[model samples]
Target: MRLMRIGEPGHERPVLASPEGRHHDLSSVTADIDGAFLAALADDPGLVPEPERLPETDIAGHRIGPPVARPSALLCIGQNYAAHAAESGAAPPEQPILFYKSPNTIVGPYDDVLIPRGSKKTDWEVELAVVIGRRASYLDSPADAAAHIAGYAVSNDVSERAFQLEESGGQWSKGKSCATFNPLGPVLVTADEAGDPQGMRLRSYVNGEPRQDSGTADMIFGVAHLVHHLSQYLVLEPGDIINTGTPQGVALSGRFPYLGDGDVMELEISGLGGQRSVCRPA
Candidate 1:
């Protein structure tokens, strides 16, 4: 199922996108798409009631917000893709290198991506995000990671290279947590619908020009390994989001120019829908 939230920022309503390309309101069944709703659906897939088709005109003009409500944690994996790590002048880590993006960075898929104050190296990363459905801590094995995932979504891990490197005291979060730095989801597709998370094609474009083009198949540490590895250090609760890193092609590599005001960014994953954001000064 392709679940979503639609309306203005902070006032979105839960909806389900039908196979026929129409939207059906899911508010009657759940107040919002969040941890509780995900857990409930996991217990009983039939918990969602018959969807009421929304008028095409209304949906066509409305804004699309992040699929899930505010999550408890916004976690990220660094250099999970070998090619990406090489471009950044780093080697593949022996274990999953983790980082955090402040939950406040979350924004709608199509919202404007803010270029932070005094910023000059803002970059784009198209990644596949995993949403946790069940609580996980010290999992028995990587195979168990599947049962804990709610679904997957398209995530743009927007970054500020200068703040991340020169000014961050070596910590990456400083450059990753600016407001609206993470533009997530036009939809959160269920795991069943997303199929294999490690085989999807992820691509990014700036102002209609291709920038990053790669596949999850190139990931050095796949989704299951990251989840299991992370659970050993901290609890992965429902609604927690894990951004599984990007595959090469970003401004940080000096391959393309950094984002500037009025630049448009378009990102997509094969099954998880796409995102489009216009860069603007904060």
Candidate 2:
């Protein structure tokens, strides 16, 4: 099953997509698809009504919001893919490289991404996003990672090279935390139903041309390792997001020109659904 929210921003209605292709209203189950609701669902799966019992709803034309509302923390993994590190002209890190994008960067899957003022190095990154279902700290092992995860979603890790590389001195968050930089979700596919996180294929396109075509299997440090590794360093709260990382083929590689106004970016993961966004001036 997949959890979703549809309608205008700040006013979306919770929804659940069943395996049989039915979309049911989830408002009766929770106020919003947020940390509290995810934590409750983790504690009690029966809290949600059965698919057949909920009212079936049509959401064909409405806007799709981020499946989970503002996460308490929006964490990111850098250079998790070896090829991506090579493309960025850096040696593959021996351990996971962590960074943070402000939670406010979250926006709907189909929303417009803004080109930050005075920017010329905007780029696109398609990633598989992990949504935490419960708090975790100092996990015993990588195998324990799945239990704390709610599901997965597609994320666009939009970036500005100038801010990230030149102006920031050393830290990378400045280029990463701009408003509307992280475009996530059409829905969140529960872990049990999302198959193997490391087995899925993720891809991206800009204005109809393919930019990235790679599988998660290429990741140097897979999902479970990242989760387990992160828990040892910080307390991961429910509804926090971990953007596993993006594969090679971004503009930062110098193979393609930077993004400008009117460019369209479409990102997709095998089972997690896809996101198509337009670029506009901030």
Candidate 3:
């Protein structure tokens, strides 16, 4: 099922995409697409009722809220892609490089991405995000990691490189936690709905010009390996999000120009759907 949260920002409601490709109200079953609701929906499909028809609202009329309403933690991996690491002048990580983005930074799909105050070198990163369904600990193998996954979504790991590196002295999270930095959603596609997350083709564009374009096949640390590695350090809970990492087409890559005000971004991964956002001055 392609589950989503719709409506206005704070008043968003739990909704499902009907077979007819329309949004069907699921408010009768749940309030929002947060942790507990997702965990319950993951366990019991019967709790949600089948709809004969979708709502009459325009598909484009509604705001696309974050696939999950509130995540316990927003974990991100740095340089998980070899090409991206090399482009940034860093060696491919010997271990999974981890960082945290506050949940407050998350915004809905199609929302405007803020350029962050005092920021001159803001950039975009299109990443494939993994949403955890079951609690995970020290996993024994990469094969077992897939079972813990609930679904997948498209995420923009927006960055302020100057603050991230030069100003902070170190630590990527400093530049990563600015407000409205993470634009997520369109939908949270269940693992069954998003077959082989590792094999999908992913692409991104800035102001209608292509910037980042690559496939999950290019990832240095695949999804299952990331899950297996991350669980060794922290307990993975349902609703925890891990941005697997972006490909090598960001502004930092120096192949394309960085973003400024009025720049729009569009990103898509095969079968998972597409998401677009506009960049504006903070």
**Which candidate leads the pack in TM-score?**
2
lDDT of 3 at 125: 89
> Which has the higher lDDT value, candidate number 2 or candidate number 3?
2
Q: What are the lDDT scores of the predictions, listed in order?
A: 0.92, 0.94, 0.86
**Any residue pairs clashing in model 2, and if so which?**
none
Over 1-282, each residue of candidate 2 has an lDDT whose tens digit, in order, gives 699999898999899999888899998889899999999999998888889999999999999899989799999999999999999999999999999999999999999999999999999999999999989999999999999999999999999989999998899999999999999998999888899999999999999999999999999999999999999999999899999999999999989888999999999999998999999999
Q: List clash counts for every candidate, in order.
A: 0, 0, 0
Off by over 4 Å in 2: none
The sequence of per-residue lDDT tens digits that candidate 3 reaches over residues 1-282 is 788887788988878886568777777777887778767866875666766544434556778789898789999999988989999999999888999999899998889999888888889988999999888899999999988888999998999999898887678888999989999988998897789988988899988888878999988889999999999999998889999999998998777777788889898888778888888888
Worst 10 residues of 1 by lDDT: 49-58
**What is the lDDT ranking, best to worst?**
2, 1, 3
Model number with the top lDDT? 2
Question: Relative to the unseen true structure, what is the C-alpha lDDT of residue 98 in candidate 1, on a scale of 0 to 100?
Answer: 92
For every candidate structure, what is the RMSD over all alpha carbons to the true structure, in angstroms? 1.5, 0.8, 1.7
Q: Cα deviation in Å at residue 129, candidate 3?
A: 0.6
